[model samples]
Target: MLPISALSGAPIVGRATVASIRLRLPLPEQLPPAVRDHIEAHAGSQNRQYLYVPSPVIADQDASAPLCAFVSIDYASDAETELVEVSRGKMLKSFLKQNFSRDADGDQILAALFHMVEHLPCYLLRYSDVVAAAQALETAFANGDAPSLMMPVLPAVENVELGWGDSEPDQPLVRRAQATVVDLEGEAFGVSADQRNIVHLDKGALRVLGLFDVRTREREVVDILSAAFPTVDAAQIENDVSGAVRRFRRAGLLVAT
Candidate 1:
């Protein structure tokens, strides 16, 4: 469990073993000497050790402005795991003031900051790659060349039915299940499940899954998402949705329409 201070949005100020660090981009070589020194002084002695850096909450002056970064970090210890937040805006501003010329363009600075943070280690899937692929898919959709898509869940195989008397009638039942793809020879692979082996779903992918209806068209789904998360970029959402669909399809959880 995280300290109540951290849970309530206070800066972490102690030693912790991190499981992962998700930065908007990797640490830049040109970081302000003070900030870099602070990080190095604070970093664990072990090489490649995970460090948690929380996603900073930005108060956008313009409500219509798009977010530049959404980074997160996960810390794991023998007892539990916690996420530590960092402010991307403050971090970038510190670096820019220290490293760049005052005449630098705002867009250029933002781009540079994004590029710098983009190098953080990702254990499973790189969100930047997902965003890139999503951009390409968005282009295809705009060109009226989007592919037909479908969402499929695990299918019933060799069902073992249960009777109503299996448990108390008024008791609420919680179902925990796992699904795996089996080859022609009945060998299983690509297993995902709840409880001990839950598959990880990023925010965008979770949203897509929530909106998914079997055999739903990509365009229609995108439209629905546009209405739901009005502040988010449609193209980015589309990319995340398409990426999840592709992953599921590859895992045999989805099929082409």
Candidate 2:
């Protein structure tokens, strides 16, 4: 005997089976719209609530985005809800950071992704599928493969009291955040300090980030990069440098103090 109305997390694996007894009944507005509709139309019986696990499965037109966030949350538990929120925060931060790194489509892409998340349609999943998915997610989280955005546990915060260091009296201090993240040679993915966004570091971006150093200024960064590639136009170099800084700032990797 299983309690009906249990929604398995967004089924990334495939279609799943969910048990529910359909009936004809009038629903009320007091309940969430999704809940009401399911009962009124499908009539899956109403006393118990359903779980809508917010997943990080980004579906492309005919492709699959990375399973960036946790598999799902119980929603009924406070701690699980908190965990889901942290995962979502990391998802957003990662999204914004990746888009910001590209051309001007960053804001638009994020808005669309969030909209998709909010309006995600719930589906019924099979019991076996649910168990399997849950097991997989549990393993990922346990093995530190899933993106929880949690930092080093035993170690304390960096030496910088505010996470950002200070410069001379008049310099616009732009240094890397105290956190030392990986450069990820292939394709890198990370979240912001607060886990509200994601950061993707490609080779080109890594080239720019490689400029970070103590007491480094924006102009110095530009000069260093320009010196490396003496063929490109000076104006283009400035634009490229500015764009990279803006992206880094948004990603919380480099803060303008």
Candidate 3:
């Protein structure tokens, strides 16, 4: 099984672990060096210093309203995962479309939890060769980019071993085929015998996907919205709220107890 950290696009030449932060408020100058360093790394990669807050509240601030200082780096990548150049065409389009459509609705938490739970099963498959699988998914993402429904997914595999002697029958082979179990974040997920490669879609990974969806939703609302000077688009607000619900669900980070 491949390490979950490896799939996060954080294992750049010098990084240690992928970092993810959820921003509720802007970052202050008093932030610790570790936090500051991570933000700097992210900004530097994109050749930008800081990201602006594009929310309605910030955009619609009046002259008399109190001013805010800075935008927060809510999410960061893991250190062990390195970001590669990926063309976001098909999956991105589907993801965007589903996000913007009026009928796009679900119990976000349940959906997320289901997805996460499903991950355990998906990884157990014996994936095909890495290059072929990666290319296929990448192509799928590129081809599906028109309306943004399915979002792009690039899955990576590592630490693979065969459960049975499927290589050759020359030698006396006697072994029971067991489902491949990949250790992801200390938890094991089952992969199928046909899926030789492992694709990890963990909390941080899904969060990034959700962010893209949220961004699209915001774009749709802002484009069609015409309201008062201080108005926030209803769609945008709903999307944000629902997104929170989804994230909470995805992480299984909710509390019903």
Better of 1 and 3 by lDDT: 1
**Candidate 3 lDDT tens digits, 55-160:** 2122221112111111111123222212232222222222323333232233222222223333321211122233344454455345432221121132342334
* Ten contiguous residues minimizing lDDT sum, candidate 3: 65-74
| Candidate 1 lDDT over residue span 72-158, tens digit each | 423222212222334433333344454443554443333333333332211211232333433543543354431222112223332
- Runs in model 3 with CA error above 4 Å? 1-230
lDDT of each: 0.37, 0.42, 0.30
Off by over 4 Å in 2: 1-171, 183-185
Task: Tell me the spans in candidate 1 whose CA falls farther than 4 Å from its real position.
Answer: 1-198
User: Model 1: what TM-score?
Assistant: 0.26
* Each prediction's RMSD to truth: 22.5, 15.6, 25.7
Tell me the TM-score of model 2: 0.36
Determine the backbone clash count of candidate 2: 10
**Stretch of 10 with least lDDT, candidate 2:** 1-10
**Alpha-carbon shift of residue 39 in model 2 (angstroms):** 24
Global Cα lDDT for candidate 2 = 0.42
RMSD of 3: 25.7
lDDT of 2 by residue, 1-257 (tens): 11111111222221123334332223222355664554445433243454332222433333322223323323221122122233333343444444432332442333344433323322222222323445545554564432222111222223333323322223444545543443222345443443333356666566766666465676776787789889988789877767766666655566556
